[model samples]
Target: MPIYTVNDQSIHVWEEGASDKQVALLIHGWSSSWFAMSPLFPILSRYRCLAVDLPGYGQSPKGDDPVSIVAYTDLLADLLRQVTDQPAVLIGHSMGGMISLTMSLRHPELIERMVLICPTISGRLSMFINMFLGPLVVLERVPFADRVTSLIETRIWRITDRVMKPASYAERSAISSEAHERIKADVRRPGQGQIRAECYRAMRENDLRGQLQKISHPSLYLWGMEDNTVPLRDASSVVAELPDADLRIIPNAGHWPHFEALVTTQRYVRAFLSTPIKLLKAQF
Candidate 1:
């Protein structure tokens, strides 16, 4: 619930564990808050864990306008600089991964290492859709368009909630009844909708294929084989571009692998961090 002013944006940040140890920043996906990363918090708490609710999500204030992924990356870099002097390990999921990758490529000095989960990168068809169809979709903000877009978003949210509910880990399941209700309450807080809209706008404009080669930090790419949101096919393309990247596929898991398989996800993440970069590369 605490807030910080980074790049003139009021960002919501939560910190746990000792500040003297290595830091890990966990960034959540689109339409998600820090709660999405709750599954790994207990284990990750041994080290410094910082989870952020990006601008326009959770308790953060809305930005002046919609953001680009690169802009979000800059915001994150600025946040890191303001929050801690130590280089932090960046763990990002979905759109969060895009921001992490952008940060790694643009401000490598701030990052010690990275763990990207089902990252969003370029897809030939998605590129065409965003470049062409996206504008048309945004047009829905107009007179009748707003209503239509709202309807569509509502339907999608319902479906996604159903899918995610079952995939939540046991620890989460114990509190499932109240967990989602809490998330909904947080989303309903003032300025959340606008923030989410801006993040979606940013994700649509982000295309990082050209900058992938600039990333020099050691990285781990984790994918859920059954992830329908960011398909496993994208993993090959991501690993191929980064010279120092390793991939791990979690079977029977969906888009939120850490939630679906919390124990496994935590175990791997800790193990990878403890080992040398060379050993991590051999883990895949």
Candidate 2:
């Protein structure tokens, strides 16, 4: 693991695989670090794999400005420019999926294909349904609201720390305590709490369904049939909006099919990636 400094932000990155293989960038979800995508590293090691901890999570440093989907995607573009000159595949989970969606739509030339795992489409239900989440949308909209919301956000994170670990794994028999701890421990650290507050606020406020229509790349949507965090109805709706998207529901898996049903998810990813997407090479 190494830290890459770009645009006054320190981003912690994990890279593996050969330089000759296709460049694949991995993005994790909200309140999570790059470790969430660690399961895919080994399986996809045949390709050039790059996983990053966005500012405020894992070992990455946070920026002073309020985090938004655009900021994260801009940082992703910066990292890609530094690593690869060719168009690469973008793989994102949860909040990362939202960022990836905006990135591909905003800068279509930079990305050739995509893999979104149980991504958030429209936040209307996710935010309104949760009592605490509804408040966040208001807090994000009001001036100087972060000052008060920051305290509430920190406390909520502390309270939900333990809950997220188990909530991520729906199939109890397939749980890996080691993997769970490795993926979650750093996120619950003392100072890491408030950084994700802005990201969550932005996620709650944005409706991504309209933006999905702009994406023209081949995309693979892998949803855990048992995912409670992002509902199947929403996932199906997401599939409907994308121009070229394939849906694959993993049975007996939860929000984290990559972790709970590792082999099956890997097989699915490999098949999707191998489907010969017309790589959009850089124009010289």
Candidate 3:
């Protein structure tokens, strides 16, 4: 783990692979840290893989910065400008995917391509989460809410983790126990109540469906067939909006397809990255 100073904030990054190879910046979703993306490291070893623990999560302190897609995109743009001269590949999941899409639209010169996994493209999420979990986030505005939220947040996430896993035991076993623990650890981190509430609110309020068509970068979109967090129909709608993008829904996989179907996910990523950008664009 290496900590880099970006916009005067200490951003923790998990760097892997050879420096001489092409750069691949991996961004994890809400409530997750760089460790959540560890499963894809082996497949992306051909590139200089850099996974970031965004400001609010993991080792990075949220501080006073407002957590929004634009704020995150600015932080990453500045970080990349300081670190790499050439454009890098963006691999983003969920909220991170929205950030990547925004980056491509805002700073197209800094991005070569993108890989979005089960991205949240609209304000609409699963009815269950929106109905149940969304209210808890709103309670953060009330007195002593942080204290109250801290106690139940862990329980809620643990149940969510189990529910998000694949149905089959073999598919569930594909994701290491340690990986699941890592995600839980992020929830247990101090001051996460405010961050979680803010992030959830931000994600729910932000919608990028109309803006995605402006993104010209050749992109790959992966969705879990059984995803309940972001609907499969929404995923298809998002892919259809993009100018140069393709969608692959992994069967028997849920929201975390990269972990549940590692081999299949890797194969798709490898093939996508190996193809010429021109060829990919021509397909659309």
Candidate 4:
């Protein structure tokens, strides 16, 4: 693990696999750190994988600027330049996916290709989703809300652990106990409430739908069939806007497809990243 500075921000970075291999930069979603992308690390042995804890999440401390998509894209752009000389493959999840899309539009040279997992496009969505996220955003403004939320979620997960356990070992590994604890700790971190609230607001205000047609890189969009957070229906329409992209739906999975269906996720990601560009585009 190493720390890289972007202006006043200090980004915590973890790298795995061989240096000689093609670079694969993993970007975690909102309220998540590097661990959110860790499950895919094992399958990326052929690549020089790099994951970062964005400011205001994980080990990285919040910078002076409020957490926003544009700020993140700028940080990542500078980070990629510092970490590698070549354009690396961008693997972004959720908010990270939004950042990747923005980067692809703004700094295409920094990204050789893209793999967006349940990415956010327009801030709009179904009423059901609004009901789900609205309260969380409001709760962030309350004092000690994080502790209460964590306690409740911890209990809920504990109660359902056995019933919710995946049948396969590979899927189980994706959401191991260690990963759960780390994610819980991230939720309870100081200033996290403000960060979360700010990010939610920023995402709601920012829209990238109009810009999708400008993205030139080959892109792979992975969406969970049952994702309530950013439903496939809300994002699937944008696939047509992308000049070169493919959408793969993961069955029986939620927002976290990598956790719910590790093997399937790996299959699509590996094939997309390894296949020849011309051949991949031909299939679409």
The parts of candidate 4 lying over 4 Å away from their true place are 139-182, 281-284
The C-alpha RMSD of each candidate to the native structure, in angstroms, is 4.8, 4.3, 2.7, 4.4
Give the best candidate by lDDT.
3
lDDT score, candidate 1: 0.70
Give the TM-score (vs. native) of candidate 2. Answer: 0.84
RMSD of 4: 4.4
What Cα-based lDDT does every candidate model obtain?
0.70, 0.75, 0.79, 0.76
- Sorted by TM-score (best first), the order is 3, 2, 4, 1
Tens digit of per-residue lDDT, candidate 2, span 123-201: 4334222554445544544547655655576675665664564455565526487876676665555455456556656
Candidate maximizing TM-score:
3
lDDT of 3 at 59: 88
Q: Per-residue alpha-carbon lDDT of model 4 for 182-234, expressed as tens digits?
A: 65556555557668777887777778877788877888999877676676665
Return the clash pairs for model 4, or none. Answer: none
Candidate 4, residue 208: CA error in Å? Answer: 1.1
Point out where model 1 deviates above 4 Å. 123-194, 277-284
Which regions of candidate 2 fall more than 4 Å away from where they truly are?
124-129, 132-158, 171-173, 279-284
The residue-by-residue lDDT of candidate 1 on 1-284, one tens digit each, is: 56888767888887788768777999987667888777778777656888999777777766785567887888889888877887889999888888888888888889888988878875222332345434643554355655565557666456435544443222233234465676555534433444455555666577666667777777878887666666665776776776446778887666677866667788888877878757654543
**TM agreement with the true structure for every prediction:** 0.79, 0.84, 0.90, 0.83
TM-score of 4: 0.83
